[model samples]
Target: MTWLLVIAGAAVGAPLRYLTDRFVQARHDTAFPWGTLTANVLGSLLLGVLTGAATLGDHRLHLLIGTGLCGALTTYSTFSYETLQLVGVGARLYALINLALTLTSGLGAFSVGHAVAQAMST
Candidate 1:
């Protein structure tokens, strides 16, 4: 059952990530890969909320959202390759900004998500 739920979540997550990436990228002519950044940060935020909610004893929710949804929604490979491409193209500043913003924003979003979940639980 858990595996089935995870598969279902992944089924939704993968394409959602792709579509989200394309949509965001299409909206911006910049080379900053905003799509990937958005997807990753959103994934992180969701996982954090899921984690906070998991304290209520729901393994299936964790597997479905945390492991499945977030796992499929975020892509370390794309992020790494984009960073490499930025470096190769001499857009070192953009690459650094991407890195710093991705890290910082992901962390901040996760923290906010967790806090929201905690508040809701309370």
Candidate 2:
């Protein structure tokens, strides 16, 4: 049952990640992988929230959201690929910016999510 739930969650998460990536790419004219960053940040935030909520003993929820949704949504590979592309294009500064933003914002989202979840519980 747990495995099944995780598989289902992955299915949903992957498509969601792809859609979000496409949407961000389309919206922005830049070649940077804004979509991947967006997904990662959001995924971090969600993980925080889900981790907090897991205190309530909801394995299925964890499997679905953490394993399935966040696992798929947060893409480290894409981030790395985009950074590599930036470097290849001779946009070292741009690549640095992407790296900094991804790290900082991803951390921020996780913090926010943790705080939000804790607050919700209290």
Candidate 1 lDDT, 1-122, residue by residue in tens = 77998898899899989999999999999999999999999998998788777688588888888888899998889999999999999999999999998999889888989888988998
- Candidate 1 deviant stretches above 4 angstroms: none
Estimate TM-scores for all models. 0.95, 0.95
Once model 1 is optimally superposed onto the true structure by TM-score, how far is the C-alpha of residue 57 displaced, in angstroms? 4.5
Number of the predicted model whose lDDT against the real structure is largest? 2
Cα lDDT tens digits, model 2, 1-122, are: 79898899999999999999999989998878889999999899999888866677578888888999899999999999999999999989989999999999999998899888888888
For model 1, the run of ten residues with the poorest summed lDDT: 48-57
